[model samples]
Target: MKMVSYLVRHHLKMELRSLHNVMSLVIFALASTYTALQVLGGKPDPTTWNALAWIILMFTAFNSASRVLPEDLTAVRAYMHWTVPPRVMIIARTLHQSIIMIILSCLLLFALGLFLGSGNMDTLSIFGFLAGMILTAVGLASTLTLLSALSARAGAGYGLTAVLGLPLIIPIVMISTSFGTDLVTGVALGQTVQNLYYLGGLSIAIGIYGYILFPYLWRS
Candidate 1:
């Protein structure tokens, strides 16, 4: 628990301090916000809004996660290697990406529904959106971080990471979109519950795969 907290704090500090990461995420957020406003007009359908949000969030996560491993290079990696356990580093970095994903998801949701006139949004639906976003982002972010780090050692690192992660993110988008449908419409109680369960279950599977695979990827 102590180690996990330390890893999370350390990575969080680095994220806050890093100009590159901040700038990239800000740019991504701006783009996402703009797109969200244009697409989700007043009283947009829940299915449509959810799909849009998922795309926006996924792209933003992809852009932001593209840099985590490359950001460190030799010195930082070496320092972390000697100071912290690999598992600690992985968990901490995963948490950092998860935070970014959630923040971006919430920001986009607000800008679209509030300013752009999404009549479909209610307090509970917004909560549901947040819930769905967290599940999708956490899994996507950790998996991307692990894969990107592995690819970082290759010449086509960024390209390879893109190839690997983009396809994997599709399921996240679908699950989140389903969850959003429930939130936006608020009609089918059982359907929404089922969608949320499926999304959660998918996230768990991906998260487990990433956690199990990350250490091996880290060494390679």
Candidate 2:
């Protein structure tokens, strides 16, 4: 537990120190939002707004995942292997990515609201939608972080992560989009509670899979 916390902190510190990476993601999200606004030529309907937000957040997650385990150099990996347990490292990385994705989700939401406008959502509905964003971020982060590890170990690069990650992440995106559409379109939170459960369940399930599978990948 202590080692996991230390590793998480280390990941956070490294991310904060790399100003370019942080700014790049922010720019990417804002640029994507601007492009969306231009393409639509105006504010989209509630469903479109929800889908666009999810799409931006999804790609942002991909961008973030591509940078996971930046210590891909053999010497650094060897040092990491000798010092930290693989399971602990995976947990820490997933936690770190989840934090990152959640923040990015917020940024994307804000950008979308600023440029494209949020749909007609009441306070409770907005809160429910925010919950969906958080759960989706965790699910995407866990799944992509695991795929990133697999891609790194295979020496196949970011393409492998995208190839392996996209199909697996569809269900998460679908559920989140559905829940979000409902919230934005004026469906009551109580009615869409099941989708939230599905999102949370998927996130936990993916994280557990990564936790169980990483040690073997690390050894290789």
Candidate 3:
């Protein structure tokens, strides 16, 4: 537990110290949102708004999370292998990506609302919207972090990460979109709970798989 916390903090600090990633994220988000607005030519409907937001987020996540294990990290990884367990490394990276994605999601949502116009959201619906965003971010982080590790091992770059990650992340995107739609439409609480359960279950399963499989990749 302590090791995981330490590793997480270490990665978090590294991320904070490096402005490149954050700058890229903000630029991409803004550019994407601007393009979306130009294409729509006006405020998009709730469904279009939700879909565009997710598309932006998915690509942003791929861009950021794919770099979690850069090609140049071999030396750093070697030192980490001696000091930290594989599970710790994977979990810490995943957690760091999740935090970054969550922040990005919030910023993206604000931007979407500002330009695209957020649909009418009551307190309960707002809760659901935020919950869906967080869960989707976690699921995306877990799935992409593992895929990024695998791609890094193969000497593949961000392109390959997108290739491998997009198909796998579709279910998460679908679930999150559905959850967001429910929130916008004011679906029954029970239905919302069921969707949340699916998202949470998927996230946990992916996290467990990444934790268990990462050690083998680490050894490789």
Best-performing candidate as measured by lDDT: 2
Q: Give the per-residue lDDT of model 2 (tens digit) for 1-220.
A: 9998988888889888986887798899999999999999999898888888888899999999998466566789988989998989899989999998898888887888899987778777877887899899999999999889888889888999899999999999989998888888788999999999999999999899889998988985
Q: Which TM-score value belongs to model 1?
A: 0.84
Q: Cα lDDT for residue 42, model 1?
A: 47
- Which candidate's TM-score is highest? 2
User: What residue runs in model 1 are displaced by over 4 Å at the alpha carbon?
Assistant: 35-47, 70-72, 186-190
Deviating ranges (above 4 Å) for candidate 2? none
User: What's the TM for model 3?
Assistant: 0.92
Pick the winner on TM-score between candidates 2 and 3: 2
After superposing candidate 3 on the true structure, give the runs of residues whose Cα lies further than 4 Å from its correct spot: 68-72, 188-190
Worst 10 residues of 3 by lDDT: 64-73
lDDT of each: 0.70, 0.88, 0.82
Model 3 residue-pair collision total: 0
Residue pairs in candidate 1 whose N, alpha carbon or C atoms collide under 3 angstroms: 42-117, 43-119
TM-scores, all candidates, are 0.84, 0.96, 0.92
